[model samples]
Target: MARALPLFGLVLLASGGLMGCGERTAARAALSPPDRAEYMGIETQLLDASTVSFIVRMRGARDRSDVVAYARCAAAQYTVIRGYSFAQHVRTNVRRSGEIWEGDGGFVISPDLPAGRRNLDAEVIVDDCREQGIPTV
Candidate 1:
């Protein structure tokens, strides 16, 4: 009976390990590291009443896809100018910084009022870009 109990326990342990293999695999797949590009600082400048431009410079050893993604993320995040959302304001030149692997491009925000040099919103956008897996560049 003692030997039988030991065998049963061993079998249970083996089965438990096998049963969790799928879950472990799935978890690893989901958490797979994002192909990250080298991050660079974000540069934002105000052109005039109808425009605010942003540039993100990034470098990657393998792929520039992250840079492109970063550009899109920036465009989406910066759509809001001042305390207003893009839905409440005009968005122009809102695009990728430039061609993929070339340079990234952003747009000028046409705010309801004259645009000024506001670093606070730009700071928030930088944080957002990092969060979205977009390289700072």
Candidate 2:
């Protein structure tokens, strides 16, 4: 019984160490972008003078909704950066591979909000994202 106790204690210690390692990994991933193997970032393409497309990529445990939100935030910021006041969402495509999620959102930016599309004000969208604690670029 004495020998068994020491062996059991050693096993517990090893398991605790392994569990802590996983916690540290999860905490680090939550705090910052994932490593290159599982990188998260955004890319933008200019489709025309008024239209643009944004792609947001995320890896590991992130939801599809989060990916779409990030893309929307990017579109809003991009509209402001391009000297536009409003953006209209045209379309979006989402895909997932293994642990990575990618969302592509297309927007048409205009100085004035258009008549019949799903329009968003650049400043208002960005502000809403900020209030919601969502990151933008």
Candidate 3:
């Protein structure tokens, strides 16, 4: 019985780890990096009810012409969006073709970020984008 219990525990841990890994892979797949820079429109709307809204539009990097996909704000950094502080989540929507990923709102915009592009945790950011209909890179 003791041996069986240990084996079961090991199996449980393994399965949990595998599940986490799967989630990471799926998130990465959704936000696979683009070959070239992509231009995404960012709009921050202050809701009348004291909540802020976000709108993201994706378009070709070279063309400042029109938008391709639209994403509405579903979530925020839980702090910055609320005007609590500046060093909070600063997420943006990234998209290539139909693929999408949500940039993490918590990351500070580095000068190296391509024009408007940001660096973020791929998995968490992508998942948030997917859930909120945001785009991904």
Best by lDDT: 2
Error of 1 at 126 (Å): 9.5
Instruction: Choose 2 or 3, whichever is better by TM-score.
Output: 2
lDDT for predicted candidate 3 compared with the true structure = 0.34
lDDT of 1 by residue, 1-137 (tens): 22221211222342454336676556333332245555565665656653555565555423343443444345435655354333111222222343323334544443342343221233344444555455442
Error of 2 at 118 (Å): 1.1
CA lDDT of each prediction against the hidden true structure: 0.41, 0.66, 0.34
- Measured on C-alpha atoms, candidate 2 has an lDDT of 0.66
Ranking by TM-score: 2, 1, 3
Q: Top model by TM-score, which number?
A: 2
Query: Between which residue pairs do clashes occur in model 2?
Result: none
TM-score of 2: 0.66
Worst 10 residues of 2 by lDDT: 2-11
List TM-scores for all candidates, in order.
0.40, 0.66, 0.31
Cα deviation at 110, candidate 2, in Å, is: 0.7
Which ranges of candidate 3 are over 4 A from the true structure?
1-23, 60-78, 81-137
